[model samples]
Target: MNNDVVVIGAGPAGMAAAIQASSLGLKALVLDEQPAPGGQRFRAIEQRYRRLRAAGKGLPASEQKGLDLIRRFRESDTRFVDQASVWDISPGGRQISYLHHGRSFTIPANAVVAAPGAYERPVPLEGWHLPGVMSAGAAQTMLKMSGHPVKGRIVLLGCGPLLLLTARQLSNAGANVVGLLQTTGPADFLRATPYLPAALRSATLLKQGLQLLTQTPLVPKVFSLTQASIIGADHVEGVNYRSRGGSGFIECDAVLLHFGVIPNTQLSRLAGVAHDWNEQQECWQPVVDAWQETSAENLMVAGDGGGILGDEAAEMSGRLSILRIAHRLGRISDQSLSKLAAPLQRGLKRLAAARALIDTIFHTPETMLIPSGDTVVCRCEEVTAAEIAAANASGASGLRHLKVQTRVGMGPCRAQMCSMAAMAMITPGIRCGQRPPPPATVRAPIRPLTIGQLAEADVEI
Candidate 1:
């Protein structure tokens, strides 16, 4: 029940941290919600490769590095608990309570690494709640894990690297990609020229971006789209988008929307870690030191969960966190830690520069951030944009007031689905100078558990 360290998540960051910690002689246990490791980026990679190879499909270069990382992680002595849903962590990051195999257990730990990754920023649009509509990341998960191709013609809407990557992955998987609609244009990339050198410093990342941009099979890709809407009732029938050429419609079976990704900060928030908003990324992030330690002693957060950096940065952050933890445990010398931290610090700076460029190039379009008056913002509560606007007009101050008056964030998702949109409506101009507000309060039982399961809990203090 006791360990030197407990790492939450099995993604690149978590795996890297746990492997490093274990190799340093720390008793590290890695817990992940997925039945397999690799997180979303490498979701079910091993099984997917086997299935694809059996079907005469070769592994895509996009997934090669991740596969190698996962392989190395698996070879490590780190203990892994797959499908372990961590619900809460005790004060000071000493213990964690998680549900595994229908049982609850509280494991004590000296240090905790929270590597919960990021999720797509939910962009609301007309008819977005209809069937056949999903986040672009979800579509990629389906394809990556089970080789489940999207049924019928699909339209990819919105911006970010994920959209382009998903489009390419789907097309390569034989899905009929109807269209690729982007909210940002060449102007956005041109605007990011000053940061281009930093972004291009990593040849691998530059090559990946080039491949995704050029490899998509969809033709006539539209850019600078505005007033994009999903036109369907019970199911997705088609998509409506506007550009300089005026409005147009694309008949498709489904619409995959993704503006960008925001860190998954619920767990860190629940752990009472101090967080601040990243104005450029427009998301909440845990306040971490250069060593990746959070304000709460012994608690570390890495990966996209801490911010919106890409996988490479996440891996480096994870290693940096583990190195710090290892040094704290006397597993590594101070001199060694200092030497190790230097390179990670440099890598993080380069990555930060690159991320700034990426964020600018694919900044979530203002139109997407602020949905139309009639658009459904909170799909779970069936709350519309007008309703939230009415609440704000009636003197609602911020996300808390809006949530109380309009029940916008009280749904099953607990604000994950609608918090960003509601916050945007309240603060129309979110910039750096403005003091960033903390995220909504996160209570215990972060993930839903049945009443009966809770009653049967066997967690020890």
Candidate 2:
């Protein structure tokens, strides 16, 4: 199938793009991997959709906007494909390959917007793989979407609004949360404070962190807590942790560990989009202009996939992307769209300023970065911290050396998980005074496509 514009994700950004495109009289099509739209933030929204659908009621305000977008596309003959995983996008001419219902299909669109949001970064603490140990966001998605019961007694670890929000959610969900642990160093926030005046002019959003630190005295606290390991062999019994001045153990069945999020840009790299390394967020995100356009002429990206701006920014980015898309398609002039969106654009600018303010107030610390000195950086090959150390010591420095010597990033993920952590251990210029490993080399099969699926996929599309 072909269309004037194809959005590869059904998240807020893609939905927004689709809406803008449809409104501007362009034929829009949206393809997504999930069974429904809303990306990660609203992935749980399907239950809400079912309930609304059952009641013969339309979507609520937020969801209604999304539904309106989908309906507009459908009504105008624009296409929407769910369970369509666009694994690879061949650049230049038009090409996209996806697997739907175990059958491969391809679509060539005149323009594309990639809104494949970010995912949790798995920082390897000792025994991180033990049951009950999960990313804070993962547990939230599991409980919210699947009704899966998380561990009974939980300790939410990490810094950011996410930890506080997750702790509150789990508490509300009936998990007895002992405490919400914040791992941010005060110095980090201090470093970020200078950026705040610009970030917090209006957004009271992260003000919660500062307020929690003062009031209740129990709700939220910022301190660095290093975990030795999650206790218990089969499951997480508790966590062994060490902090300044003393070491102690927090007895709990589960520990929700979240360092932060990193963009899932495997597909973009495969598509040859340029990416900038956000060292603070510890991930590589696509580089997009103010218009959300990427290096490729016909490609654009938005949201956390572009950078870690969180949920609100995600929705706004998605919406702005479609406005930009309309301009690129020649359906609407840039001046016209910008003038029409002046109010919304000003509001977004204010929010962006506010988010920056709070992120500085509660940013995660660098000290909590991946542990070095014999810590296992890669889990796939059973490679140990000692092996990585040896690789670093043996004149073999940098990620390539670590890979050649320790086989850290050579696993099934081909370095997605381990590369960031490995680089953390091996500081740049440690080897030959050269730059660090360039982003992992990307090729076809961005994600694992079965042989049968590959066979069904035609290159011509």
Candidate 3:
């Protein structure tokens, strides 16, 4: 189907983009992998909101805001397809390919907004492959979608606001939170002090973060963690950790890990969009302009897919990205676009002021980024850190070379889970003024699909 714009997510950014596109008199089609709207940050908000309301309970402030956005999206004239997994976008952003209901379809669009969002940065440690060891985001997803806490004694480890938030959520959900382990310490906070003034500009966010820290369950907490390993053979038994204060082991059935989040750049890269390494966030993100338009003519990346901006900023950036598309399509005049974009730009600037401090304070520990010995860096391929190190030592120059040498990123997940860690291992140090290696190459069939499914794809050429 032909449309003015196709939005490739249903999160805050995607929803906001579609809503803005419709307001500008443009037909927008939003394709999202979730069964409903509200991306990971607000996963299953609608269903949970309804259930809680019926039970005479109210949703969290953040979730209620997400539900409000979802309601607006549902009320808009823009069309949306849920449970649609977009696997490819033609170069130059002219066509979209997605799988829905076990069938593949290609559609033409004038412009595409990629808001694939972010995923938790993987922290590869010993025995992390054990069952019941998952990312904090995964645990949060379980809590949000099903209102069920993860079973048994749990140890929440790693850094980032999400770690604390997930711990609080799980604790409130009646999970047996045995311990909280933080990789960040006083040194990181000291490093972040320079950015505190800017962060203070968003007092509401600071207050919320403080609340999360103080209101979390009173459990044994360890800070300045240098290393962690799951002490399990088949399933999670406990977590062995080392911190500045001391080293200890926490008996737990589940270990939830979180370091931070990185942009989901697979689709953007597949579309041949140029990306640059964000030194601050220590991840590769699609290069976008002030308006969120990528190097490709009509493709834009919004929200965390472009970079790890929070959900509120994602919504603002999403609206900002569509303003340019709407203007280019003649749906809005120059003056109209300028007027419409002014407030969103202001909001984005305000939200971004705090990101520096957040990134600094929660920077992924160096040890976790480049694990050594038998730690499995690539879970899908079972590639260990020593294998990657050995390959790099044997002349694996970059991501491509490493992939060829050791198959570190050729797994079913297509480097999504392992690329960052592998890159960390391959390039342990970079000389000053030297450009870091480009991200792994992205190709079609970004998501796995059967050969028969590809052959039966409905083409709209």
The number of the candidate with the highest lDDT is 3
lDDT at 256, model 3: 95
TM-score of each: 0.96, 0.86, 0.98
Question: What are the RMSDs of all candidates, in order?
Answer: 1.6, 3.9, 1.3
Alpha-carbon runs more than 4 Å astray in model 1: 55-57, 431-437
Evaluate model 2: give its lDDT. 0.70
lDDT of each: 0.86, 0.70, 0.89
Ranking by TM-score: 3, 1, 2
What is residue 157's positional error in candidate 2, in angstroms? Answer: 1.7
Worst 10 residues of 2 by lDDT: 213-222
lDDT of 2 by residue, 306-350 (tens): 877766566677667777767766777768887866765675677
User: Could you give candidate 3's per-residue lDDT for residues 417-436 as a string of tens digits?
Assistant: 88888877767663233466
Off by over 4 Å in 2: 48-77, 185-189, 204-222, 226-228, 279-282, 341-349, 428-436, 458-461
lDDT of 3 at 84: 97
User: Residue 416 error for model 2, in Å?
Assistant: 2.3
The better-scoring model by TM-score among 1 and 3 is 3
Greater lDDT among 1 and 3 belongs to 3
User: Best candidate, TM-score-wise?
Assistant: 3
Count of steric clashes across candidates, in order:
0, 5, 0
